[model samples]
Target: MFKADLPGLKEEVTVEIQEDDRVLQISGERNFEEENNDTWHRVERSSGRFTRRFRLLENAKMDEVKASMENGILTVTVPKVE
Candidate 1:
């Protein structure tokens, strides 16, 4: 799960898995603020597309992989096939 102050919902994230290579990619774009020519004493905010990738186990059930976002947290489930 990814934890952060992100903008957008579960329906707006990109999640993909490659069965042949056992690779999982999770990506999302965050957009929720306009600078509006404001001066910043402390700069602490993020925007644009965030991407993460991982190499799954050989036995991982790539076809059943799923992703979801809730309350700025991203959850990805990759079941192990026995």
Candidate 2:
């Protein structure tokens, strides 16, 4: 799971899921705006590709996985089914 806060103008993000070796791989990108100016004092932030892997249990339902992004935050829900 990845977590970051973007101040002002909520960020937009996307998530993609894939399965491999009984594990689910989640990857996505978060888009943000950058300020351009002639003067710069310091820069401290992170942006780019990100990924997370989750081991699936025997009862986990991969087909029922759901994901959504809102207000600069992304949420993924994987349900366990019988």
* Candidate with best lDDT: 1
lDDT of 2 by residue, 23-76 (tens): 766565545436788687565656666667777777777777776555655566
Score residue 52 of candidate 1 by CA lDDT: 78
TM-score list, all predictions: 0.70, 0.60
lDDT per model vs. reference: 0.71, 0.58
Model 1 residue pairs with clashes: none
Write one digit per residue (lDDT tens) for candidate 1, span 1-82. Answer: 3333445456657888877788888777767566667575554566677887789888887678766677867778888878
Looking at model 2, report the run of 10 residues with the lowest lDDT sum: 1-10
Total backbone clashes of model 2?
Answer: 0
lDDT value, candidate 1, whole model: 0.71
